[model samples]
Target: MSRHDYFSQFLHAVWHGESGHPLVASLLAQPAFAVYRNTIFKGCVDALSANYPAVRRLVGEQWFQGAALAYARRHMPDDACLIAYGDGFPDFLDSVDAVRELPYLPGVARLDRYWSESHLAADDAPLDTAGLHAVLASGRDVQLAPQAATRWHWEPAYPGYSIWNANRDPGAGPLSGLEWHGEGALLTRPEGQVQWQPIGLGACRFLDACRAGMGVAAAAGLAQAAEPGLDVAVMLGELVQAGAFTSFH
Candidate 1:
């Protein structure tokens, strides 16, 4: 390799901890560069931590950082000209054998990672049920956005969502009733905030129907089918209150 190319490779390695170069420690001593590197890693950790605060709290900051460091080290990423990384950390967490018992750990990471993307998504005005009632009044079939996701886990062990709900600081401790249970949710970045609204049985079934690529009318019918006594109007109200709708094509 040309001298310039070799130097560039070495620099990249040093930046990501891939190299055992003796100069690395000394270079890290330069307060400015160290701060820059720390910022880079901190950004990675913060994004991942925001999603995995429960894991971090459960494992402690030092342990979490150690994992993040090890993860960032292996996945140095080929795009050096890139602005950020850690896109692969979630899967990395899943692949590691040590954390196998943390079944919901990967899920938390996935949620956080998606939230990051949502934060960067195109701005959208979420659908409000006020208009939704009018839509139903108009009898038009509605559909959720491609960006939306929802589910009801019969097994409640995935407290991933609740952990995320708890503040970044672990002071609140695990969310009350920390054990997993049936949960319905709608995730969207309507109005520039990543909203994670927990849904009830009626709304959960309805949203799941919609998420399965079902039309609004069909999904609503399925929801009513499962919950025969569902108050369609009231359920729709609850959905609307949770920012259910967005602009139509």
Candidate 2:
């Protein structure tokens, strides 16, 4: 096999626990190779811990590390940027035997992923109230573009956003008295800091419409259709304040 092919198989063997691969069998037997393998495993576990702090917080260090190790064994990082690693972690949580009873764990992990993505997204100035008003004055046919750092998610079956919000902040008080219901979260980086807020289904649909490249009027219609009692004007003003829009044209 070519050197590249051998390297590829070596990586597969390391990640998948298949050390019997002929090309890597002798190397895997060396003591130093065991150290290198352990280092790789530690790096993956540490990166995953950082990427999903809320998960770590919810499950405690011991439990979280065990889960992270299992996940690392099945999936290796695709690139050098460890900050963006663990994209599949949320889904992986679903199949974990220990967390099968905790259905909300995956959703919380998803919000964690969204936070990381928003933090790394390219910078852009968000649309303020004045800019939104000017756009409305010009015409209603204009399309509003969501900010590059904008990320939103809706969980129709669980209060995932609420649970995530409670656990994300290290200094926050213990979560209590939460109403058990579906929730949606909207994340944006309007300035240097990432901001998040719980939103309703109407607002989530509105943002979805905007992301789909719909014009202002069409997006409003869709939002209102999803929520018959929705006040489009009020919702637009709230989103404008939240820096959901970047520009309109």
lDDT score for residue 223 of model 2: 87
Q: 178, model 2: CA deviation in Å? A: 1.0
* lDDT for each residue of candidate 2 in 37-139, tens digit (9 for 90 to 100): 8889899999999999998998999999999998888888998878898999999998888787888899999999999999999988766567668768777
Best by lDDT: 2
Clashes of each: 5, 0
CA lDDT of every candidate? 0.61, 0.86
Q: Name the regions of candidate 2 deviating beyond 4 angstroms.
A: 19-23
On residues 1-249, what C-alpha lDDT tens digit does candidate 1 reach at each position? 578866775667455644454455456556777677667666655655665555676667887888887776566545653333567877888888878767766666665565556565655555654665677688787775443422232214565556655643355565565655544445665455666655556666776766567777777788888768888778766665655555332
Candidate 2 similarity to native, TM-score: 0.93
Per-candidate TM equals 0.65, 0.93
**Candidate 1 lDDT trough over 10 residues, lowest sum:** 146-155
